[model samples]
Target: MSEKKTINDAVSKRYEHGFVSDVAADTFAPGLNEDVIRRLSAVKNEPEFMLNWRLKAYRKWCTMKMKTWASLNIEPIDYQAISYYSAPKTQDGPKSLDEVDPELLRTYDRLGIPLYEQKMLAGVAVDAVFDSVSIATTFKDKLKEAGVIFCSFSEALQEHPELVEKYMGTVIPVGDNFFACLNSAVFTDGSFVYVPRGVKCPMELSTYFRINAANTGQFERTLIIAEPGASVSYLEGCTAPMRDENQLHAAVVELVALPDSNIKYSTVQNWYPGDENGKGGIYNFVTKRAVAHERAKVSWTQIETGSAITWKYPSVTLRGDDSVGEFYSVALTSNCQQADTGTKMIHLGKRTKSTIISKGISAMKGQNNYRGRVKVGPMAEGARNYTQCDSLLLSDTCGAHTFPYVDVANATAKVEHEASTSKIADEQLFYLGQRGIREEEAVSLVVNGFCREVFDQLPMEFAVEAQKLLEISLEDSIG
Candidate 1:
């Protein structure tokens, strides 16, 4: 085959995490009602207060409407037609890896996540959430030894009900928005973390979400709390099986950093993004936010290269004096994907500061947009914010956009915003090509360089994975 043919073949490769595992699952019937909420809560054996909270959120969702985002064209969703919950068939939660289903373990192994403690990555604790339940959590004993509670959301609710009740909806209220509200009512499973005062977590806590069963919407809720003088770094990864019909993944994440604490959250989302025709893939609508107290810091770094439609704004609220917030993102859209993702910084305390760096890459028929907001409250004297949004396009058929919103209530507050849109330069490509670099590899090199700034914020291992995902996503955009 010719060189161009080989490149074309590489570009048209199928989604790697697209195969479904053959495992028996107990799935709810397709529909939503108060009864469904009650059943879901009961299935997890949740506390009575949790049931009441879900009911309240469900009632609010009944009166709410689906929101429409600017410049995003999404098809109407039938909420009633989606199964609210699905889980691998089990009598009770697995107590150990041996008790877990073999097929599920193999499934995770295939995805490059080993749940076995001895086989998994060292210095990392993982809570593996498959479908609607957490199947395994590694390094639990070690985390408990250091007063760090890292486990599935369901486990947290059972083992630490007081902590869960105290901070569950404090940051992201039950009725935050349409998707988040929906998640509040029907969310099945996710990860939860709590670091005690004056203690820093010894290992990186992680959660890997896998959407397996068909016709089931994965609504997971994650909450992380760091006490005074505590610090932790958390990472999240997600994947889904490919099908002919679109699936919905609406998740809510809340983080709280107390005085002098620090929390860094990273995500490498590689959900199935359908074929060139946009027939399948995932509709990812997620809400992630963090609140930093006095002298605390919260950072968000995400590498998004999947999902047919991605709509999420990971935000931070600097609520105490001298708090800091940062957002670094690299979102890539390829083969008819559409992404409307960015971050929000709300400075509510004196002398608080924030930084936002967003890089958007569009290839083939992808449409990428960065919509961000920076707000400074009246009490935030001497607050500062800096935002930079840059977009890279690989083909003329794709488009990139930026919409930034800034509101400053204090004259002492200072904010700066910079944005640019550019395409792969022919001269640069020619230079790389003259050195015997193939067209596709040259394009990948340029894309990786453009995204290095954001990648630098990720963990060492994840940064390399992010680069490979970007290269694979840019396939077929070049001739």
Candidate 2:
């Protein structure tokens, strides 16, 4: 097929690669039973204590019901029909990219993350996760030199259970939310990083996740803990091939920053978005939170462009005196995509401060919402918050909304909020076209400029990729 024909066909089909893999999978019989949980734990060779923890979470999830407050209209999920565990049929994960499956490498290359791995392997440390397992983690020896513990969550569970046990679920508890409870129950794999006291990581730590199988949910749990005086920057990228059946991707990420430490978490989510008609796409329901302990800091930056249905709120709790929290986000939804995302900041420490900047872009019947909250506790004297939410409507068929909630308990706290919604001005586009830029390029340039604040917050590697993603997502939004 011609390239244009292929693009048109992909748009018509909704899911680009929804085909099932031929590899035999170790799957649990369609259902969410205790036996299924036990078998999954056994397959992972998890310790008995972890099994008990899973059981507790499973029981809690069973009693909970689906939430209906959000503006999402999702189909009822049949937990029984999903394959809880599916991995490429390999006896042991490849030690290097050379030994890894060629098909997997091709997928990453297509998604623009292979170069990221190549750069990381050349002295930069990366923990790359394909489907449910960590494929290759480069520069382990070098990272170890600085006393940084960077490895898969499963590996950390086995090698450094003491650290895992001490901080697991500390930031986001087991019963935090419905999706978090489910993730706590069935999370197969994810990354774990622990920067020891006073040691700054030599390089950026990153995880590239790809979901390749059908009816297989991607429930990964990420936990990062920076001890006293330590600092680290972590990046997470996600992609999935096209599929007809809606896939559930429920993940939980918990970050903890101890005294005098700082943690920066960045995410660029490009999951498979169903076609123009919204046939099949991933239901990305994720819960991510961080706790800034005494005099610590945490910042969250995200660029969301894909996923047919996305519901996420990355939040931070300023629990220590003189701590800081920040959130910068750009959420783009086009062609029937729906996203209700933002952040929450809870100020409990004295002199705590938070800044929120959110940009929402909607086009072609898409719906986007920025729902956020800022809370100042009674004891949080001299707390301050600044919030800004702006929306860009690419077409008349799309919709954008913002809901900001603020509760101030301390009289001395200072808070400010500003929001605006605007459409792409025809005059602006015409002026750019007169300046010799093509219509598409003009639109992309304007959209990029609109999202520069959030893009600048991402790491250098991801900032460029995020810009490219925005260009692709806004291709048809222009005249």
Question: Top TM-score: which candidate number?
Answer: 1
In order of appearance, the predictions have TM-scores of 0.97, 0.93
Segments of candidate 2 deviating more than 4 angstroms? 1-25, 95-99, 115-123, 473-479
For model 1, the superposed segments whose C-alpha errors exceed 4 Å read 1-13, 473-479
Q: State the lDDT of candidate 2 residue by residue for 31-82, as single tens digits.
A: 6788888988887888878899999999999999879777887889999888
Per-residue CA lDDT of model 1 for 1-479, tens digit only, reads 33434333443456899999999999999999999999999999999989999999999989999888657889899999999999999878799999999999999999999999998777889999999999999999999999999999999889999999999999999999999999999999999999999999998889999999999999999999999999999999999999989999999999999999999999999999989998899999999999999999999999998899999999999999999999999998878899999999999999999999999988778899999999999999999999999998877678999999999999999999999998878777789989998767776788789998999999876778778776644455445
- The CA root-mean-square deviation of candidate 1, after full C-alpha superposition on the true structure, stands at 2.1
lDDT for 431 (candidate 2):
94
Best by lDDT: 1
lDDT of 1 at 261: 99
